[model samples]
Target: MRLWLGLPVASALPRAHLCVFIPISERSRKDGALSLAALGTWAQEQLQRDAGAKVRFVSVGSTAGSPLEPYTLHVPGDEEVGYKRLPVRILKIWHYLGQEDDCDWVMKADSDTYVNLRGVSDRLSCFDPEEEHFFGVVHAIVPPRQLREMWPALYFGHGGSGYVVSRGLLPKVGRSALPCLEDMLEMTQGDAMEDVIFALCLQRRLDVQVESYGFLRPGGAWDAQLAEQEFVVNFHQARDELLDRRPKAPLQRWLHWDAQPPPLHACVMVAHPVENETDMMEVHRKLRADAAAQVLALAPTASEWAEPERMPLGLGRAQCVPSPMALARQAEVRLSAAGAPVKAFWTPKQLEQLSQCLVHSLGKKRCGWTDIREQRYGLSYWPPAQSSDACAEACCRSGADCSLFQYRADEGCWLGRWEESQAVASDKVWQGAVKVW
Candidate 1:
């Protein structure tokens, strides 16, 4: 489909679905295993669970490639993979991966970042591979007054937060389709940030936009509340800045509020800023536990957990097991007690009936309603809808002003003019009706 670095872009050989690359420094590795150690095992676990998945994790560095237990790729460059030389490291990654032509997508992440490989796959599902799409938490590029003439207010994805590059655009690197390493190093005087350089290359050279995925949180932008409900793909913790509100770069604005962690929500796929190797392992352990809890929640019957053999992690029989429906009710009660307005309770059968009737009345096959129960956000409130269909209709009728709507069988409908970057986990909330423009 494309060609670059004097090599064929697409080959007849089998290709992995995604190639996740993390640039590492000898200093970081000396500090500990780096996030890749746990991540490699995590990736392998995912592969073991799903045979069809072909995702590879490779840690790239500038030094001589010493054989790591799992995987490592050494690119020729200066040994220091620090801020100033980040562009070189990144360009090297692209060039190497591009020549391989063994993956549909190339994801460049920092060693400090933890990636949820499954979540990455899920997010990429909606996008097409043929198109040159860049996915990440996008930031607007605003230069100082002095440099306004030279630099416009453009946008780029944060490298620490990690970003994805489609295979289609990989071959373009170091060629006319994209800037060569020499040009990039010269243009930035070898001191430019890698993410900014990447954004510039995609926008000016390839005329492509960086599609922002709000779920990818970086710095103090991590929302502890939203992660409880939404499927957050990744989180970036660069240095001690995960909790710091200070902007990493003068060109980027610090938009999100600060939030703490510890009781990491089950909905978060990837988490960032785990600078400590022990913390990285702990994060993975906690995520595995949460995943197991999800499996327990989805169990068909409480009796299933009665057997000691089936019980996992020595979960005692004395543990009071609650049904999924019961748990949902408990969550609703908590929200209701905390100032959430009470609404009518509809049985499953009744909800299904309402859903069918609303579909019939609205004459739309797909209602587009998402069961975001235990989640709530936005400032606008509208009359309650009887069903998710009714909420979608209301949002659609509200015109361009409404970008999304949250509906609850009990609490009714809420319209949002702007797409919410964060939503708190609440009871009985169903978010849907994204206005297609």
Candidate 2:
């Protein structure tokens, strides 16, 4: 069976760790309304207004663009734009930013996309920056014909919408993904899809957890109504469709303001395919205006406005499971704290008692528990727990169905029930126990 996991539960770092990366093409830069110059200028202005915000917008592309903007980075690659060279371009991008250590997360957004820092921050608040995670719109579709043999059922994150990589995994992309480059090119016969190859490298090589959020969508319009119902963070293909100039329909009447020219709402975090400078500005202006209006609405009086309380990270999602990496960090902290505070409490009598307890520790703890589960199973297949004790406690309180508990250093904890089995020698790696009373 295919094992699927939910989103992250622990929030170790703040949203300041997220870095926004956008890829722009020369064709889009020159002719398309969603040019690098337009998007970069707007993003730079937004960053300027919020001086304290550390969310950097780094745009990457070939060398043949106009003098690069402060937020834009030019990588050395052929200026060709298509699926054939996308993998190389993406590799170049990763290689360029491989040494990024300040931010714990990198969000790769399209150039035409208008990203809302607040929205992105909210969506990512619950995730741990130290852990390896890949988030985007996940599609379980077939790869190109040439790659069918290599990847039978390819599950990839759609890059057109946007995708995020945690700091623990992003750095390894450049250094680790190089070995598979030539093989990947040959497998696809030079027609490589960036998102597919990216997913493969992360899942197969780095063992990063692939997560999908329902709120993160591909093509949709943002308005007050849709924003309220769906917590949409990324709205792809935000450009207008067909403009009817035929007799009766006026510009305002003909345009679907809700979809095409997106109506400004505080809920929208990122809107893509804004194919023109004018639409980009319009969306930007509406966002700013709505933000100011919200501030005014929240004020007790016209002149006096209380600062809004910031929601703590990791509280956005309801039920969550802490990742293995997060559990390891927690274990380290617990170990350090356990020793630091009791340095002075070790008197002569206490030391003697401690030595005695350590000597008889194994027999005492092992008295009321059986290692039946360890003889038949391992904790590698179980979900992660904060500690072994926590895992056993969870099994105890998990009702009659939970008869066995297993724990390991790397895998955390496992709880299950199976037919009664003969007792076997206990193991250090997979410690399985069940309380008698």
Output the number of the TM-score-best candidate.
1
TM-scores across all candidates? 0.58, 0.53
Look at candidate 2 and tell me the lDDT of residue 427. Answer: 56
Which tens-of-lDDT digit does each residue in 329-370 have in candidate 1?
Answer: 222321111121232222233233333333333344233444
- Local distance difference test, each candidate: 0.51, 0.49
Per residue, candidate 2 scores C-alpha lDDT tens digits across 223-268 of 3323322122223323332221234533232233233333445445
User: How far in Å is the alpha carbon of 384 misplaced in model 2?
Assistant: 15
The superposed Cα distance between candidate 1 and the true structure at residue 129, in angstroms, equals 1.5
Q: What's the C-alpha lDDT at position 298 in model 1?
A: 59
Question: Top lDDT: which candidate number?
Answer: 1
Query: Backbone clashes per model, in order?
Result: 4, 0
lDDT of 1 at 52: 21
